[model samples]
Target: MSTFGELFRVTTYGESHCKGVGCIIDGCPPGLPLTEDDVQPQLSRRRPGQSALTTPRDEKDRVTIMSGIEFGTTLGTPIGMTVPNQDQRPHDYSETDLYPRPSHADWTYLKKYGVKASSGGGRASARETIGRVAAGAVAEKYLKIVAGVEIVAFVSSVGKVELPYLEALEDGQPIGKDFSNFLDHLTREQVDADVTRCPDPATSERMKERIMQAKEANDSVGGSVTCIIRNCPIGLGEPCFDKFEATLAHAMLSIPATKGFEIGSGFGGTKIPGHLHNDAFYRKADGSLGTVTNHSGGIQGGITNGEHIYFRVAFKPPATISQAQQTVTYDGESGTLAARGRHDPCVVPRAVPIVEAMAALVVMDQFLIQQSRQASATLLAPLHTPHHVLQAKPQPTV
Candidate 1:
């Protein structure tokens, strides 16, 4: 269960407050040029103590590549990486020994395994994402090299401090003017320009204030991240049970604290009739077919349609807060428990890279699977349908 991906599999190890945490990546293509530099920037962005709004955990989150590369080139072998826990304070979590943190993994983990880590939330800790981010960097490198794919994620909302772009559109209403532009060319620098990572300067400021309010109150806030995957080739997702959007949803919801996942128009798409919500097709100047709109979120029937794939991931407020709450202990005795530890007041800011990483993993694995299928299918003779069968359903023109 710890492993993710089929061809580009990654199995994460270690835990919060343990010696360290990392992953082993299997099935990476051979001879790709990679180094610590490619992986470090994303990890640095995900690490703690970056700004006033985040936890002051003071971890460099420096990664050490143990194998799978020699002199900056992959050898078609498993890749290993690790990031040590330099600032763990197991003693800080002494209160958890008497009680399970509400909405955290403590109670369920104990009930399932009959034991749990004494310090941090064990596998439930956000620290567990270090391996995901690292492995994602590798998969992203390959995707970029082979298909020029690009992935970016940013905080879109922090407790209602949201961009106007995410607002649901009514029938005959058009998308926000900047929505397409934002998804098409937004850069990580533009996203990382603000501490809240919300992309809009004014909105980022509001999100920052919201997070600070929670930090000051010894409470926590929740928010959502919007991610975009551009330049994905057509026919990437598996239909039936493993649709592209479904796999993406699986990937996003797997992260710690994730509560919701929506692609394209998501829930709002349900408001309009088929005619108004449909993405009409058009012929591009280059003679290729394109959609006049992207209500499908760059996918059609669970496969990429050569448009930007955009989605949103919602994270719940961190449960491990310093605020005192009346809750039952392990033995059913109720008492006031105030948790102690360094945790993000709003996880969206730090969650941006994690979201991007998971997106890359999903895209890369799906790409490899589809690519292999196409390669094998190319060797077979083409299916020649009868003219009557093809004419039964008239296809539309651009």
Candidate 2:
């Protein structure tokens, strides 16, 4: 189930707090330029201790390319990559095996597998997502070069300060009039101005104050992320089996702490009538058909319709709060457990990059599938030949 896609499959492996985590990408086109450098930047964004708001665990998160490339280009083989755990605190999790943390997967995993690793939630840890992000970077690069596609994701809500998109602007604007513009407006000093990553100077300051209060109380908070995909080609998804929205949902939910997902008009459509929800078709001045509205979110009948694709994902607060909580030990005895290891007070900001990465992966995989079908159809086209010239040429040769 970890493997995804037909023409552009990727399989991720390894565990959190383990020796390392990695991914193997198959079906990548040969001779595409790729290297470790291409994937590392995204990984750095997801690594812990990158900012004051995130966990204090310092992980370099350096990526090592193991195979599938020669001289910085792909060999049309499976690309293998790994990132070592440089700052593991196995000691912090030694007691976790004996007393599984409440609200965590420890008990469920034990019931399912009869045994589980003690260190850092084992495979269920958020650390498992590093491999996913790294692989996604590769997919993103491919999408940009091959299809002119771009994806952007940012924290739209932290607890309650929601960053709404501007109504007049399209989703793909270089600096869309909402959070995108806010991000652009801030300088590097402004970015470091707040721990919550909110672009509003005042709002960011207040969010930081609230997070600090929660930290003092040994608690955590949750929020949401909004991602936009631009320039996706129409007719990219297979109608029944691999709808674009379905694939994207699968990828997004695979991340840890993801609780809710909604595409265009999702639950909101329930409040509106069919007429209000439907996207009206119109011809543009450029002689191209376009939709006056995007209630369908650039997709119709499970296929891309070339409008901007956008969605939102909600993440739950990290379960490992420092406050003492009631829990059952491995022996079925009740005990009080308080998590000791480093953890983020809020995970939404760091998750922005991961969200964008997963989106890129889904889009790039769908693109490859679309391209393969097109190539096959092209090869099947009829060819024309000159019969008279062929007969005369044969006679002259004789």
> Which prediction has the highest lDDT against the true structure?
1
TM-score of each: 0.95, 0.87
Question: In model 2, which regions exceed 4 Å deviation?
Answer: 165-203, 381-398
Q: Candidate 1: list runs displaced more than 4 Å.
A: 168-174, 385-398
Clashes of each: 0, 0
Residue lDDT tens for model 1, 115-197: 99999989999999999999999999999999999999999898967887766453435555478887999999999998898
Tell me the alpha-carbon RMSD of every candidate: 3.0, 7.9
lDDT string, candidate 2, 322-374, tens digits: 88898778898998887888898888878877898889888878887777776
